[model samples]
Target: MRPTDIDDPQYFHRVVDCQWACPAHTPVPEYIRLIAQGRYDDAYMLNWESNVFPGILGRTCDRPCEPACRRSRLPEDKPVAICRLKRVAADYRGDISGRLPQIPAAKNGSKRIALLGAGPASLTVARDLAPLGYHCTLIEKDPRGGGLMRTNIPSFRLPEKVLNEEVDYILRMGLETRFGEEVTSLKAVLDEGFDAVFVGTGAPRGKDLDLPGRREADANIHIG
Candidate 1:
């Protein structure tokens, strides 16, 4: 056990298991290591570069990285609580309002994109693309944005206020959202002067299991 390893078991494991995790291949250990050292601003920026919803993920990830934690071999029968630790770091950092990580401002006059939907992918694309001055218009038919986030998902599992705050911040960064306007077809958007359009309409249906003689089971069984 090295000097750094003596501090916290969770922190120690996060440093070692970070590299193989992130899909965007971000410097995971570097940011978490920074958090361990109390260098919060740098950690926030480092985490946000690849994953803008750092605060959200910190609180609500399925935590695949935890299973990879080196401390799982310990007697506790659980790995380092990386997700909760991330939430602790983000919570202490206060509001990240208007202080987004620095990126290139020049547009280079590239392609114009019309993104239809305000889900996670749409939000991520908007966050990255809009800063570059790309003309992005996120259209949704619902009264509010956030796709499944605003609806379907229960408030207890995922707090609506937190979701709204993060979504609002992302939207403030120049992602134009038009409500109650459903694009029935892709051709409509392209015809309206958009060079390209990205659709992110997620799954809007659910399936039911058809077990034998289960149809009337609910009606017959009314427990007191």
Candidate 2:
């Protein structure tokens, strides 16, 4: 390892393999231990600080940590329930809505920023900046705020209530929202005099193919 890697605290922390494997580098074992100790509030807050959406990801995260688990490599052993454990913390926490980070009132020095999309990335940016007295304007094309989360993901996997709760919590930052407004021009947004702009235009449209048999009747095929 390089000198910087050696000096980094994560190098030591990485001994807990689950945390090292996580894309967000969340302290998986730390939070799990907290959960086991019945410190649900602390565990949830730790998760919130690390990934910002414990409840949402607890339900729908594609677990990269599981396969990297060192325990799994051991004889007849299984990986810890890192993702699900996060849900245990979120689900059993004493306070529900109160855990959300409060947005500060914009003072004279508040910065005005424009977010190009209302997807997870842009929303996360707003969540971080809003607390620091930034005015966020989320420009979206969809009828509702969530970009692909609401449009693409099946309800069975990620319930609407959970997604909406998290999204609404971020929006509660006094961030202005423009619904049903699709952005086609960047110059127009720049001309409007925003200090900064963040574009998080999520995945493009799904593939559409024109197969042979030419509009055969009695075929009920769905594209998505």
Candidate 3:
């Protein structure tokens, strides 16, 4: 047998099942240990490094890590409350405004990026690029950012304040915003001479079922 290449990063990730299962591959144990030690700020920052919106994700994420937790293998043992623990860190953490990335006064290059829709994906892109000194413009039909998050998600499930706080963090990074305007033509946008354009407009419609009695039950049957 090949003596198990421990040096490969995937090997370590596999050894930690929960981390491996996480899409972000966040150092799960490290943050958990920080939480255990009552280092809420450190724990929150650790989570933020991998997942941009720790507080929002902690509340809404369909935690894949829990199912893959090693403790679940034990008899009568439940998986750790990783999701709730993340929320706890967010709830208890101190002010982190100074910890966020600092954007340069002048743009790094002549590259101007046009991001359509102020959804999570576009916001994340703006967050990453803005700090690196790329000129990012966010155009949204809505009066504000958050896209479907504000339009679709119930306020109870995801409090408006919590969503606003995280989204504001990215917006404050000196990115340009053109709200309440929807783009009708891609060619028109291209004509404006943007170095690149990113489209992140989320799906607003639900797929309909083509089964029998589809027309009869249309009023009562909701696709989503």
How do the predictions measure up, each by TM-score? 0.76, 0.84, 0.89
After superposition, the stretches of candidate 1 with alpha carbons farther than 4 Å from their true spots are 1-16, 24-26, 74-77, 101-111, 203-205, 210-224
Candidate 1 differs from the real structure by a C-alpha RMSD in angstroms, to one decimal, of 7.3
Ranking of all predicted structures according to TM-score, beginning with the best and ending with the worst: 3, 2, 1
Weakest ten-residue segment in model 2 by summed lDDT: 214-223
lDDT winner between candidates 1 and 3: 3
Native-to-model Cα distance after best TM-score fit, residue 60 in candidate 2, in Å? 1.4
lDDT of 2 by residue, 19-73 (tens): 7778778888788889989999899889888787888899889888888777789
What TM-score should be assigned to candidate 1? 0.76
Looking at model 1, the pairs that clash are: none
Candidate lDDT (C-alpha), each: 0.71, 0.82, 0.90
Shift of residue 191 alpha carbon in model 3, Å? 1.2
Model 2 RMSD vs true structure: 4.1
What CA root-mean-square deviation does each model show from the true structure?
Answer: 7.3, 4.1, 3.5
Q: Per model, how many backbone clashes are there?
A: 0, 0, 0
Judge candidate 1 against the unseen true structure and give its global Cα lDDT, from 0 to 1: 0.71
Error of 3 at 37 (Å): 1.7
lDDT of 3 at 66: 96
lDDT of 1 by residue, 52-157 (tens): 7666777667777777766787887887677776666666675666587333465437566787888877888888877777767889888776787777667876
How far in Å is the alpha carbon of 102 misplaced in model 3? 0.5
